[model samples]
Target: MEKEEYLDLYYQMVLIRRVEEAAAQLYQQGKIGGFLHLYIGQEAVSTGLISARQPQDRVITAYRDHGVAINCGIPAKKVMAELLGKTTGVSKGKGGSMHMADVSKNFWGGHAIVGAHLPLAAGLALGDQYLENDAITICMFGDGATNIGYFHEALNLSKVWNLPVLWVCENNRYGMGTAVERASAVSEIRQKAEGYCIPNDCVDGMDVLKVRQAAEEAIRFVRQNNSPFFLEIETYRFRGHSMGDPERYRKPEEVKKWEENDPIGIYRNHLIAKQIASEEELDLLDEKATKETAEAVQFAETSPEPPPEALFEHVYADVS
Candidate 1:
C-alpha cells in the first residue's frame, strides 16, 4: 500500500472510534434510541477487510455494523443520523443501528437476526452466479451465528453449488454471554468450515494489516475459484454486546487486557515505526476524526425526522 493509503486507513480507524464513542455518549443521553452496538475494538476487521475488496464485491454484516457501514462508504453523518433516527439516515431512519444499507455501494443491510442472514448471503452469491458475474459476496457474522442451523445450511449449499461467497466469522470470544468453548462443538471456527469442504483460514483481527492480508488472499481465492472461503478472525468487542447489556459475564481486567491491543493504536504505532507517517501527521488525522465526528453529530441532531405519513414507506420488499 502507498503511504497515503496507510495514512487514510489510520484516519478511517480513528474516525470509527471517534464516531462510535460519540454514539455511546448520545445513547446514554437518550438521544439515540434502540440497541446501539458499538464496534469499539473491532474496527480493524472491517477496515482492513473491506479495503481489500473491489467495488463489485458485496458486503453483508451482522447487527454490530456502524464500522462496517462506514467502511462500505456510507458517510459518518448518515450513520449518525440513522443512530438518531433522522430522515437523512442511510436507511432513511427506518433501520436504526442494526439495519444500515446502501445497495449502490453493494453493502447489503446488516441483519439483526443471529444466523438468518446466512441464507440471504447464499442467495446473493447465487444471484451473481446466475448472472455469470465475477463479483463475490462477503458475508460477515459473529461467532455465535455459526452455532445456528442456518449457518450450516448456507455453508453446505455454498460449497455444493460452488458459489462465490467469502464467509467471515468475527469471533469476539463470547457469543452474547456464552463463550465459544461452551457453545460451539469446536473452539476454532475454521475447523467448522472444513466440514463443509470450504477453504478456510484464521487471522489476528486485532491488527488491520494481518486481517487485510488474510482478506485479500481469501477474496482472491473465492473470486478465482468461484467457491466459498471461510475466514475466522479472532476479534473482541471491547464494549458490551449492545448498549443495553449489563456486561456481568466478563471481568474488567480481561477487557483492559484486550484494550492494550486497540486496533487504532496498533496501526498508529506501525505507521510511525515503518516511517509511513510522522506523529504530527497522524495526530492531525486524529484531530480531523474528532472534528468529523462532532460535525456528524451536529448534522444528525439538526436533521429532520421521518414524517408519520411516510411510516409505511419501504416496509416491504418490492419484487416488481
Candidate 2:
C-alpha cells in the first residue's frame, strides 16, 4: 500500500472506533435508545473489505452495522442521530440503531434479524446481473448467523444462480453469548460454503491488509466467473454482544488477549515502525478523530426530531 493509503486506512479505523465509543457513551447516558452493538475491535474487517468495493457496489450486513454505514460514505453525524432516534437520522428516526439505511449511498440497511439479510443480498446481486451491471454485493454477518436456515438457502441460491455476491462471516469466536463451538456443529465457517460448491477462504480479520487482500481476491473471483464466494474472517469484538450483556460468558483475560492484537494498535505500530507516520502525526490523527466524534454528537443533539406527520409520509408509497 502507498503511504497515503496507509494513512487513510488508519484515519478510517480511528474514526470508526471513536464514533462507536461515543455512541456507547450516549446510550449509557440515556441519550440514545434501542439495541446498541459496538464494533469496537472489529474495525479492520469492515474497513478493509468495504475499501475494496466500488462506489456503485452495494453492501448489506447484520445489526452490528454502524461501521459499514460510515465506511459506505454515510456521515457520522447522521449515524449518531439515527442511534439517538432523531429526525436527522439516516432512517429518519424510524429505524433507530439497528436499521440505518441510506439508499443514495447504496448502503441498503442494517438488518437486525440474524441471517435474514443474506437472501436480500443475493437478490441485490441478481438485480445487478439482470441489468448487466458489474457491481458486486457484499453480504456480511456474524458467525452465529451462519447456522441459521436462511444462510444455507441463500448460499444455495447464490451459487446456483452464479450471482456476484461475497458472503462474509465475521467469525468473532462467539455469537451473542454462545461460543461458536457450542452453537455450530461444524465450526469451520469457510468449509460450509463447499457444500454449495462455492469457493471460500478464511482471513485474518484483525489485519486490515490481510482483509483487503482476501477481499480483493474474492471480488476478482466473483467478477470473473460471475459466481458467489464466501469468506470467514476470524476476528474478535472487544465489547459484549450488547450494552445489557454482562459478558460473564468470557473471561477478562481472554478479552485482554484479543485487545493486545487490536487492529488499530497493530496498524499504528506498523506505520510508525515503517516510518510512514511520526508519533506526533499519530497523536494528531487521534485528536482529529476525537474532535470529529464530538462534533457529530453535537450535531445530532441540535438536529430537530422528525415531524409527527413524517410517520405516515415515508411509510406509504405514492400510488397516484
Candidate 3:
C-alpha cells in the first residue's frame, strides 16, 4: 500500500474517534437524542473492513452505525447533522442516530432492532445474484445479535442459497450489558456460522491493517465462491452501552487494559515503525481530524430542523 493509503486509514480512524467524542459531549448537552452509541474503541473494525469493500458492495449493520456510515462515505458533517435531527442529515434528519442510510452509497441502514438486518443482508445479496452483478452485501452486528433467531435463519438461507454476503460479527464481548459467555450458548461466534456451514474466521479487530488483510481474503473468498463468509472480529467497546448506561457490569481495570491496545495508538506506532509516516505528519493529521470534527458539529448545530410537513414525507412511499 502507498503511504497515502496508510495515512487515509489513519485519518479516518482519527476522524471517527474525534467525531464520536464530540458526539458524546453533544449527547450530554442534549443536542442529540435517541440512543447514542459511540464507536470509540472499535473504530478499526469498520474502517478496515469497509476500506476493503468494492463500491458496488452493499453495507448494512445494527444500530451502532455511526462509524459504519462514515466508512461508507457519509461525511462527518452529515452524520452530525443527522444526530442533531437537522434536515441536511444523511437520512434527512428522520433516522436520527440509529437509522442513517444513503442508498446512493449502497449503505442500507442503521437497523434499531437487534439481529433484524441479517435477513435484509441476505435479501440484498440475492438481489445482486439475480442481477448477475459482481456485487456483495456486508452485514455487521454485535455478539448479542447472534443469539437472536434471525441470526440463525439468515445464516441458514445464506449458506443454502450460496448468497454473496459477508456476515461480520463485531464481537465486542458483550450484548448490551451481558457478557458473551453469560448469554451466548457458544462464546465463539464463528461456531454459529459452523452450524449453518458458512465459511468463517476470527481476527484481531484492534489492528486496522490485520483487519483489512483478513477482510480482503474473506471478501475475495465470498466474491470468488459467491457464498457467505463469517468473520468474528474480536473487539471491545471502551464506552458504556449508551450515553445513559450506568455500566456496573465491568471493571475499570479491564477497560484500562484494553485501552493500552488502543487502535489509533497501535496504527500510529505501525506507521512510524514501517517508515510510512513521521510523528510530525501524524500529529498534523490528528489536529486536522479535531478541526474537522469541530466543523461538523458547527454545521450540525447551524443546520435547519426538518420542516413540520417532513413528518409525513418519508413515512410512506409516494407511488403516484
lDDT of 2 by residue, 1-320 (tens): 78788888888899999999999888889998878999999999999998888888889999998999998889899998898888999998999888988999989989999999999999999999999998999999999999999999999999889999999999999999899999998999888999999999999998998999999899888888999989999999999999989998899999999999999999899889989999899899999999999999999999998988887786557765
lDDT of 3 by residue, 1-320 (tens): 88898999999999999999999999999899889998899999999999999999999999999999999999999999999999999999989999999999999999999999999999999999999999999999999999999999999999999999999999999899999999998998899999988989999999999999999999999999999999999999999999988889999999999999999999999999988899999999999999999999999999998999998886668766
Which wins on lDDT, candidate 2 or candidate 3? 3
The TM-score between candidate 1 and the true structure equals 0.98
Choose the strongest candidate by lDDT: 3
Q: Provide TM-scores for the models.
A: 0.98, 0.98, 0.99
Cα-based lDDT for every prediction: 0.94, 0.92, 0.95
Extract clashing residue pairs from model 2: none
Write one digit per residue (lDDT tens) for candidate 1, span 1-320: 88888987888999999999999999999999989988999999999999999999999999999999999998999999999999999999999999999998999988999999999999999999999987999999999999999999999999999999999999999999898999999999899999988989999999999999999999999999999999999999999988888889999999999999999999999999988899999999999999999999999999999999779777679855
Off by over 4 Å in 3: none
